[model samples]
Target: MATFAMTRERIFRELVERSNRSGNAIWLARMIASWRVGEGALPDYLGLSPEQFNNLRSHCFSDIALPHLAVSGKTVDYSRMLEKQDLETLLGDFRAPDVAETEWIIAILVAGCLGSDHLWQDLGLWSRSELSGLMSHNFPELAARNNKDMKWKKFLYKQLCEMEGLNLCRAPSCQVCQDYGLCFASEESTSVIDQVERNFNRDA
Candidate 1:
């Protein structure tokens, strides 16, 4: 069997290569690549299991991306989220004096929320409040980077809404706001996103 480090390295390299070949955005590629490597190594590094890694990936692709796409009006084709040209345009439009910090925030949010189970389900019921709370408590640095007038919950909700409007989530939902009712259930369901988020929060 390959050593954990070696497996992680291989997985990372494969993800990078695949992303490059598919013309995936660098940031998106990095996010997935990290998960691919981390999922493989985390079990050995921190006593997780292969099943957990699979669950993490499932939650990410489904719960995180699904609701996001619903709200953002974005469509994902195959395994691709943002097209290369569109991603380039977005990167250009959002250019800042400190690009690194912006990138870090995006990366952190993608890693934390996309891989989380809690953010998905019945129209992402727990997403806004719980995730906002988690960010406020665990990632104060991220919270500090936002404009002073922006509250964490407000920021997260706004971003999610924007992403939905942009159709970045996959297949965007078209119903008018007033016509839509919450799709998520108040109680726990057997959703992968929910399970992973619960596990992550407990571990933290």
Candidate 2:
């Protein structure tokens, strides 16, 4: 498994390097290469319309293809994020001052909000640090506010909760909360990106 892990890691690095390696390309490549959205069509999982997906595919993954994408139609509808429009607006407001196409990223992150795992895992991003990098790149102000390094999903929802003047978690003080681990715990031992690389090497 260790040997295969290295192979997977090398394969992933090569794929990113082979591509343009722009921040957008790297993020898209990580998600696409991860292949972890086991239950939905790629575009829907990525919170993108078919047109948007196609454009990104052409620009970022032109040299790589996946069977998952060929499975057409929306397997799951993440459109109704349960009254989370305010959250979307907040994300947009903090988007990087100099970047383009961040709205697409905001849409993707909003779609990811509907998942049960960590936000990065839900987005098939492979690692928490990668998610952090993306956030720092595109939502620097908001990301900077996460001084305690709270989990991205928890942090985002917490931010949303605070923005709406609600304390849904009911933990006015996190230090005393029983679910502190849920907010600040470390990720699992294996990077899901390894799984993505395995799948990419096997199927792409």
Candidate 3:
């Protein structure tokens, strides 16, 4: 497994890099990074008071979603995607035994920020192997059965979008927008387009 310094900035940056490559995952990743890089209480990022945050966490962790993750032969449920309890446990599961308490908790909060959305279907926030790698690295026993699943991430993203009142739909004009290419461009193409736009604007 690859090991690196687990600084908040590092984790935030890692998620951001993931976002750059992810189609719809960009929004949640940006929100999570903003929360981490900002100077505020944890609840502030989610618009919850400390007490409410605690309450939510308590409610969530008490009954984890997808308890089948730890058991064998239990079928995974995709229909019940956006339960608050499941969303909470999505973050809670990141608190692996090997992770530092602070980092682990931050990981959970990051997951929370990711929340439920249909965009997740187009832009997978994390793939099955990525999740398996993370779990296997931190909690090997959980990886023994190796059921790599990421549908829960989509559910979590949907929930987050609902909580924030975010509209995840692409605009009808998105396909025709000049800036749409920025989202789909390769690094080199993006750079060339940036230069061209700068020159065009300068001449105008």
**Top of the candidates by lDDT:** 2
Candidates ranked by lDDT, best first?
2, 3, 1
Q: Provide the lowest-lDDT 10-residue window in model 2.
A: 36-45
Tens digits of per-residue lDDT, candidate 1, 1-99, equal 135336535644554444323212233333343343333111121111344333433432322221111222322232443333333333334434333
| C-alpha RMSD values across all candidates | 15.0, 5.1, 15.9
Candidate 2: the clashing residue pairs are: none
The per-residue C-alpha lDDT of model 3 at residue 198 equals 61
Alpha-carbon error at 53 in model 3, in Å? Answer: 10
lDDT for each residue of candidate 3 in 1-204, tens digit (9 for 90 to 100): 012113434645665554323321333343333344321112231433345444433433323211111111112232453454544554455445544322333333343433332222112222233333444455455344333232334434544565678867466654675655444332222221243356568999
Predict model 1's lDDT versus the native. 0.35
Task: Give one digit per residue, the lDDT tens place, for model 2 in 1-204.
Answer: 455446545656766876766677677666655443342123443667667666665666567553434222444464565646777888988998677657678877776777666788777676789889999999999999999999998888888888878877767787989999988989755456455466678996
How many clashes in candidate 1? 16
In terms of lDDT, the poorest run of 10 residues in model 1 is: 40-49
> Scored by CA lDDT, what does every candidate get?
0.35, 0.69, 0.37
Best by TM-score: 2
